[model samples]
Target: MSLRVAYGARRLFVYLVALVTFGAASPALAKEFHVLAFGDSLTAGYGLPRGQGFAPQLEDALRRNGVRAHVTDAGVSGNTVGQGRARLKWTLDGLKKKPDLAIVALGGNDMLRGLPPAQTRADMDAILAEFKRREIPVLVAGMLAPPNLGPRFGAEFNSIFPDVARKYGAALYPFFLANVAGVRALNLPDGVHPNFQGIKRMVSGILPSVTQALNAVEA
Candidate 1:
C-alpha cells in the first residue's frame, strides 16, 4: 500500500478507538475550541506529570481567560522535524475534527541533534503548507538553537519561524520556551524539560499568540 493509504488506515483505527473511549464526552469536546499542540518533548510534557504537560496547562490557561479551548497533545518525545512532517497528515486525519488552530512548536530536537537547519526549514514549510491546504490556521511557536551551537546555527534556526510564518501568513510566537529555557528553577532535574513553573511560564508567553490566533480562527 502507498504510504498515504497506510497512514490513513492507521488514523482510521485511532479514530475508532478514540470514539469508543470518549463516546459521551466527544460531543461536548467538539463544542469547545480545538487546538492541536504539535511538537516535541516540550509539548508532550516530557518529565512533568500527566496533567502538567504543555497542552493541558495551556488549555487550562486559555479557559481561565475564557477561551474555552481543548488542546490536543500531539507531541512525541524525541521527534524531529522530519518525523513531524511524516506524521502530519495522519495526525490531522485522526482528529475527530480538524483543529481550529495548530501550534507548530518543533525544531528543538532538530537543533539538539544538529540536523541541518535547511532540512528543518523544509519540513516546517511543508507542515505549514499542509495546514494551509486544509484551511487550518497555524500558530508557529519556535525554538532557538542553543547558543553554544554558534551564531550561524542560531541564525538559521531562529530564522525558521518568521520565515515560515510569513510564508504562510500564520501567527507567530517567537520562542516556545520564552521565559523558561535557561531558568534553572523552572526546569526539571535534567534541565531540559520544564517543571510545572516552567510550563506555566511557557503558557503565559504563548497565551497571547494563542488568543490572537484563536480570534482569527473565530473570525
Candidate 2:
C-alpha cells in the first residue's frame, strides 16, 4: 500500500488503515478480481509480521467471504498524497496487468504535517484522474482529519476524500477506521496503528463497501 489510511470518518487522525500497494509478484494472481491496496503504514503492515498486514488479511477475508481476489500491497510508509501521486504511474506500469479495482487511501501524512488540504485534494484529483483515464474503477477509502487539529482544519481536510470521490465518480468509504479508533485496546503501544484484532475489525467494517464496489465495476 502507499503509506497509511481507512475505516470511517469517526476513525480519523488516530488509527491507521490500508494504503495502496506496489510490491513484487505473487503466485496465482489470476483471480476473478485483482485489487491494489494503496496507502501508507497501514497497508505496509508497519509493525506486524507477514500475512498479517491489510492487503494479505483483506485478501484472506475476501476469499473467506466468497470473493476470489488477489490484493497487492503497494504501500510506501510515510508517504503523502502528493508522493502517492508521484509514484502512481510507475507503479501501474510495473504491474503485470491493470488491476480491476484500486482501493486508494492517502492524505493522512499531509494532514499530520499540517499541509494545506487543498493540496491534498489536488493531488488526489490527479491520482483519481489517472485511474479513470486508465479505465480502472477506484474505491476511494476515506480518512477523517484528526480533531485535535481544530474544526476548520478538520472540515477542510475531511472533505477532501468525499469531494474527490464524487468528482471522480469513485466509490467512497467515508472513513477507513470506522470502529477501531478511540478504543484503547484496539491500538498498538503508540496509540496509533491498530492491533491484530483491530485490523480484523477494519476488514469487517469495510468488506461490504468493498464488495459493492467490486460488483459495480465488474458488472
> Which lDDT tens digits does candidate 2 get at residues 1-219?
323434445366333332212122222233478899989877777788788888988999999987888899999889999999999999999999789999998876887799998899999999999999999999988889778999999999999999989998999998788888778888788877888887888888889988999878655
Q: Per-candidate RMSD vs. true structure?
A: 15.4, 17.3
- For 130-208, candidate 1 gives per-residue lDDT tens digits of 9999999999998888889999999998999999999999999888988798889999988889999999999998899
Candidate 1: stretches off by over 4 Å: 1-31
Best by lDDT: 1
TM-score of 1: 0.85
lDDT of each: 0.91, 0.85
- Report, for all candidates in order, the number of backbone clashes: 0, 38
